[model samples]
Target: MLIGYTRVSTDDQHLDNQRSALRAAGCQRIYEEKISGAKRARPELNKLLDHMREGDVLVATRLDRLALATRDLLELAEILNRAGVGLRSLGEPWADTTSPSGKMVLTVFSGIAEFERSLIAERTTAGRLAAKSKGIRFGRPPKLSAEQIALGHRLSSEGTSVREVARMLNCHHATLYRAIGTYITPADSN
Candidate 1:
């Protein structure tokens, strides 16, 4: 069985062309969807996958219509392979997983994709390290400054309630406690 999957990024786009192409390529059952390839959850695509069985081939008009990312495409191929199903793209004839040459091409492509991901991760780590070395801070800035922290400590020592001090400083009581290194006990509060 040659099952077909068709998708469009938006409702404005039509799936007619893809459907015709898949039909011409001998697709027995066609699943249509109007959703972005970037989205992870595609109901029609999932349904089509679920409907496929061993010895069946999933056909798409183009590789991009199936998945926008190389990782995603490779993952789908892996799932099909595990289930004894094959994947075929009319636009990218070399992407047919039913043939030996196509499988070899997919393997090579997956290796290249993995290498590209590793390179991206390495570059990101290096960029973050360089930024840190240049005194660039990440995450939220401290709510209380050094002077504010000192004032919080003094206020806590002087029998002011943690909540009162926090209210005066316009911060949370927990923030004031962290700044002062103490949580004023209820017995000590005025």
Candidate 2:
């Protein structure tokens, strides 16, 4: 059985071409959806996958119709393969998992995808380090400014309770303790 899956990203796009191509390619049952390939959730695609059984071949008009990323495509292929089902793309004949050469091609593509992911990770780490060296702070800004912290220290030194100072600053007492540090006396620790 050749089960077909077709998708269109938006209302403006139509599934007619893909449906026709899949039909011409001998698809027995076609599942259609109007959703972006970037989205992980596709009801029709999920249904089609659930409906497939051993020896069934999952077919699509093109590789991109199934998934936008190579990693996603490879994941889908792995799921289908694990279920004893094959995957085929009408646009890319070399993508047929039912054939030996096609499996080899997909294997090579899988390796390339992994290498690409590693390169992207390395580049991202390096970029983040460079940004940090340039004093580009990430994440949320501190709740208290340097002046506010200094004021907190002064208040703690003046025998003001940590709770009272935190209340004045509109923050938690723990926040005052962290900012004022050693300025908080034994009595203030309570």
Candidate 3:
């Protein structure tokens, strides 16, 4: 079974090209949606995934149209691969997971993607460090005073939740979390 999944970001974005290409590619049952790929919840995508079975193949027009983020793309591929279901894309001939050669190609591509991400991370870290050397302060200015920090610690020492502390301080959860890396939680406070 060749199950095709087509997507359009907006109502104005035409899915004609994708639909036509998938049909030409011999897709019998096509599932489609017009929604943002950034959305974590896609009804049609979910349905397509749920419908896929072993020996069945999932088809898409392009990698980007299929997944919003690289992590999401890889995760979806991992799921399909583990389920013995194949994923094929029209835009990337080398990304066809339906054939042995396609599988090899995809393996190589994954290596390349990992290498690229590492290089990008190194470049970004170097750039940030270089700018900081010239007296460019990174991250947000400290909004919490010593008294507030002490209050947070005191409340945290008690039974107050981190959420309550954050709400009282008008700070992000991560900000307070990083500030107090491993504080005694309710379970650990005893």
List the RMSD of every prediction in angstroms: 5.7, 4.7, 8.6
Give RMSD (Å) of candidate 2 vs. truth. 4.7
Scored by lDDT, model 1 comes in at: 0.91
Q: How close is candidate 1 to the true structure, as a TM-score?
A: 0.76
lDDT for position 170 in model 1? 100
Give the local distance difference test score of model 2. 0.90
Query: What C-alpha lDDT values do all the predictions have?
Result: 0.91, 0.90, 0.85
TM-score of 2: 0.76
Model 1, 1-190: lDDT tens digits are: 9999999999999988998998999998999999999997999999998999999999998999989988999989999999999999998999999999999999999899889999999999999999999999999998998778778888878999989999999999998888777434444776
What's model 3's overall lDDT?
0.85
Q: Which prediction has the highest TM-score against the true structure?
A: 1
Flag regions of model 2 displaced more than 4 Å.
Answer: 24-26, 50-55, 79-84, 157-159, 181-190
lDDT digits (tens) for residues 83-190 of candidate 3: 999999999887889889999977876787789889999999999999999989788777676567667878876989978998998988677776666444455757
Q: Per-residue lDDT of 1-190 in model 2, one digit per residue for the tens? A: 9999999899899889898888998998999999999998899999998999999999988999999988899999999989999999888999999999999999899899889999999999999999999999999887787778888888878999989999999999998888777444445669
Residue clash pairs of candidate 3: none
Q: For each candidate, give its TM-score against the true structure.
A: 0.76, 0.76, 0.60
Candidate 3 accuracy as TM-score? 0.60
